[model samples]
Target: MTSCSPTLEPPSPSRIPAHHVPIIPPPPLPPGPQDLAFSPPLGSLQAPIPPPPPLPPSPPAMGTAPPHVFGLEKSQLLKEALEKAGPVPKGREDVKRLLKLRKDRFRSDLCWILFCADLPSLIQEGPQCGLVALWMAGTLLSPPSGIPLERLVQVATERGYTAQGEMFSVADMGRLAQETLDCQTELLCGGLGGPNRDLVLQHLVTGHPLLIPYDEDFNHEPCQRKGHKAHWAVSAGVLLGVQSVPSLGYTEDPELPGLFHPVPGIPCQPPLLPEEGSPGAVYLLSKQGKSWHYQLWDYNQVRDSNLQLTDFSPSRATDGRAYVVPAGGVQAGLCGQALLLRPRVSSH
Candidate 1:
């Protein structure tokens, strides 16, 4: 089991200064294949090649990751998508390939770190939300630890969690995760009912994986008032439209990168995101575009990655089950049961 949910509270007095912050948009999708010779430390997004018409659905990935969709477009595209909206999954096979890449990884060497993020059920005895998020954060900011699971144990031990021994503590979880990512974190208690999906996309575009709290029922389980259990997963990345760099300002909105414009309807009250640090803190993927595309590290597991997720709108109540959360009523906001953990910028 992964991290379970905690009883949620109201919003904090201090909110993330999202309104003032400019949502950095991803650059135009890369035109064509970039020379493998050049590396993208914080530069361009490399996309996959298209398959010839007819035989297959998704072309095989050339390397470690799958085909690219948006290249650098993460937010501008998402915002545009919010306006027009796209198709959600209808059934099993449909959900599997809906917006996910054929493979688990992205072409960027930076994302190679994601491969080390495997939080199998065998690793820990019980639910381990903090440990799961910690491993992901560590892989995101630092080089891949040659032995990831072992590395997680080592870090937990150093944090004095080994002494605690398989105990589930939110404090320990947050602290360990904070230390691993070399960043700070804040709890987004309110507005979680509607993670906006747009805001979640914006956060992902900023390269901070959102540690979200999901009531177990959302994960295809039956629940009673007393049987409220929470689960956590990191929103790592997406599989959308991406490609090789063809030219300047060429972007798309299908997968998350598109032309930039004012994103309407961002709520400040009961705001649900963390503060954006000073300008230079978020690495810019393009200097010329309206906004920058912060790189993300996607763990790519079924639980963490949305590759096989059928938990969104339209599919909210599938298989003849009712998951309708009444707005501001008794079962509102997933019963007012969600939280957003935005990664803070590290002082060190």
Candidate 2:
């Protein structure tokens, strides 16, 4: 059996042994300062040896310079930063925010309405009474008693009087007066640049009233006799007092001369009187091309000797119906003719 079986050595161990590699250490350098003296001087070398002095600092290489030190431009960097900051909001909300910021910083709400001496007095007296008086008479009336200068403004706003409504606030009144003065200034300087400019300015500055005459009597009181006459006239006068007169620019139209006709810088139309028996007639004064018309009433006549003037109320004659009064009404004293108009002053 031993002979037949070939000598088969046991199978060698399956795994090979790992080898350990040796690591060689680096050689040590000679001593520095202490060994320097032991070495031969550089001049004693075979070739003419040069002495080694101190080494200069290393210069910066061209491409190796630091980013900031290379003087890199900032435009690209700034663009990148702005891109990261993102987009901004726009339109109404942005505008509102900006307005609020400005208002808070400036304290604009605390600003007082600016007024000249004349304008302040006028505003203090209330628009219906004071401004109306000024427009009619070129001055304040009777020193403006019984009216709180401040209350007038409060009442005006309460009555729905507003600049937007064409009814002015105290501030608006001041602005208008200032504007009037400015216009006068332009006139004085002949800024209009026409031959008649000076003349026109002169008339305005002189306070010449614009007037137009009408043949019809809008006032009906002439038919009434005695004590009864003043009653209707007074009511009519009171109504006229509170009514708003149209601006010259609005009422001046040549097409409807019966209603509106421009006569130079000013125009006046005669007041029409209602017939004695007429049941409160209604007359319309309309400017051509305009949708609006003014309503005037002729009610009962009331008389005060002070009321005789065209500026007084009850308008010369009355027939218990409303009729249009010419612009600015009749002047205060024309040929001993009274204004015949009386304005009613009351809180709305």
The alpha-carbon deviation from the true structure for residue 225 of candidate 2, after best TM-score superposition, in angstroms, is 16
lDDT per residue as tens, model 2, 1-348: 000112212222224332222212112222333212245567785554345554454544432221110011324543343334322222112223433454332222221110011111111111133223223222222232322322323333333333211221222332222222111111111111233223322232232311111111233212223212221111111111111224443242232121222233554332222233333222111010010111122222211221232332453345353322323433311111111111224459
In model 2, which range of ten residues has the least summed lDDT?
A: 284-293
RMSD of each: 20.6, 44.4
lDDT of each: 0.32, 0.24
Query: Which ten contiguous residues of candidate 1 have the minimum total lDDT?
Result: 284-293
Residues 100-134 of candidate 1: C-alpha lDDT, one tens digit per residue: 54233333322110101111111122334434444
For this target, which candidate reaches the highest TM-score against the unseen true structure? 1
